[model samples]
Target: MFRTVQDFIEDYRDESQNTLKLLNLLTDESLKSANTPGFRSLGHLAWHLVHDDAGMLRRIGLDFKAPPAGAEPPESAAAIAAAYRETAESMLEAASRWSDEKLLESHNMFGRNWQNGLTLLMFVKHEVHHRGQLTVLMRQAGLQTAGVYGPTKEEWEKMGMTAPK
Candidate 1:
């Protein structure tokens, strides 16, 4: 869990950039990719990251520019990437004002009382979870994925090393 607002900020800065890199790789048509028919599509998962970030922050009394909960994602992959970038900036700006003490305060989140720190932690964890899903969808759509923690299989080959099987 985040103990200081700065911790969350620093982590978010890195993670959000990683997300942006992957988002930029998405093609307009690839957004339709999913694990199976009738499942959530790549577009829906990406847009959820955008909307949920702002919605969760707003619920905690930090309002920012983001799509409304029910808003449909644009067909353009660039638009979704732009929205994610913009909303992430807004969230960083809004969160910058929070003090460590404020992070320790309890607030009702999803019907349970939680520290603001936990909420911030959830922000990163939730995004990471969906990001993993998006990567699978990206692969299914035949798109190359950006590396998050380390080089991908192709990236390893680019480095002239065998990728672990």
Candidate 2:
């Protein structure tokens, strides 16, 4: 969990950028990619990350510009990516107003009382989880996925390094 607002902001900035990188790579056709029938599509996962952040942040009195919860994913990939970018900036702005003490305070989240800091942590983790799912769908859609932590296999190959098996 974050102990200071700056710590979370710094991490959130990097993570949100990584998400944007992946989002930008998506094509309208790729958005329909999914592992199986009736499963969540790549577009749905991406939009969920965008909208759900608003709901979670609002719980801690942090409001960002985002689509309402349960909003349908847009058909245009560019629109989805643009919305994510906008919300990321908006969220950072709201979080910047918080002091470290505010982070430590308790907030009602998902039927449980949670430290605001923990909620921030969980929100990032939730995004990361769906991001992993997106990479798989991107691959299925014949797109080269970007690396969030390090280089992706395609990136490594471009760098003249053999990717791990």
Candidate 3:
């Protein structure tokens, strides 16, 4: 959870970049890949991140339009990424206008009250959880996953370096 506006902004920027990097690793074909017959596909996971963030924003009293419903279960990967970027930018801009006291105050979401900081932290965690799934899906699809938190195996090989022990 963030205590200061700067803290949230810095973390958001870093995390959002990581999310984008993961999203970029996905190809149009791989977007349909799923772990099992009835499981959510890669594109569905991407789309969920966008809509979930918007829901979080709404919980905090920020108004943003939800992404349009897609004919496909989760929509195109590109569309999901685009919506995430747009909503994230707008949320950051709104956050800039909030005072420290306001950020720390409690807000009601889903019948429970939580500090704004908690809500923001949950948003980051939610994205990271889905991103982990995407990394696995990318590997299954024979795509090169980026070294998000650290070097991916492919990245290490490309650099002529041994994989970490």
Candidate 4:
């Protein structure tokens, strides 16, 4: 969990950029890819990633510019990528104002009391979880994905090296 607002902001900056890199690889047509019928499509998940930050941050008393919940994702994947970048910037700005003391304060969240710090941590984890899902769907859609956390198989090959087992 984050003990300082700066730590949270820094982590978000890196993770959000990672997310944006993967999101930019999506095409409008690939948004239709899903693991199964009735499952959430890439479009829905991408849009969720685009807007979930503002919604979660709003719960912690930080408001940012994002589309309303349930808003349709723009038809262009580039637009979705652009919106994610902007909303991430807004979240960083809002979170930067929090103090260590304020982060330690408890609040009722989802029927349970939680420290503001925990909430911010959860926000980062949530982005990571969904971004992982997006990567899987990206592969299913035949798009080359940028690996986060480590180099992908193709990335390793591009460097004329073998990926570790």
Each prediction's number of clashing residue pairs: 0, 0, 0, 0
Residue lDDT tens for model 2, 36-154: 98888888888887876457778788877788887889999999999999988999998998899999889888889999999999999999988898888898889999998999999
lDDT of 3 by residue, 102-157 (tens): 66878877778888888878888888888898888778877888888899988899
lDDT of every predicted structure (CA atoms):
0.87, 0.89, 0.75, 0.87
Weakest ten-residue segment in model 2 by summed lDDT: 49-58
For model 1, how does the per-residue alpha-carbon lDDT over 34-132 read when each residue is reduced to its tens digit? 778788899988888787744556667666677788899899999999999998999888889888888888778888998888888988999999999
| Error in Å for residue 25 of model 2 | 0.7
> What is the per-residue lDDT of model 4 for residues 1-165, given as tens digits with 9 covering 90 to 100?
789989998999999999999999999999877889988898888989988634656777877787787788888999999999999999888787777787887777778888889988988999999999999899998998998999999999999999999
On lDDT, the candidate that comes out on top is 2
Off by over 4 Å in 1: none
Cα deviation at 129, candidate 4, in Å, is: 0.5
lDDT of 4: 0.87
Q: Give the runs in model 4 whose Cα sits over 4 Å from its true position.
A: none
Q: Can you give the lDDT of residue 109 in candidate 4?
A: 79
Q: Give the TM-score of candidate 2.
A: 0.94
Q: Return the clash pairs for model 4, or none.
A: none
Q: In candidate 2, which residue pairs clash?
A: none
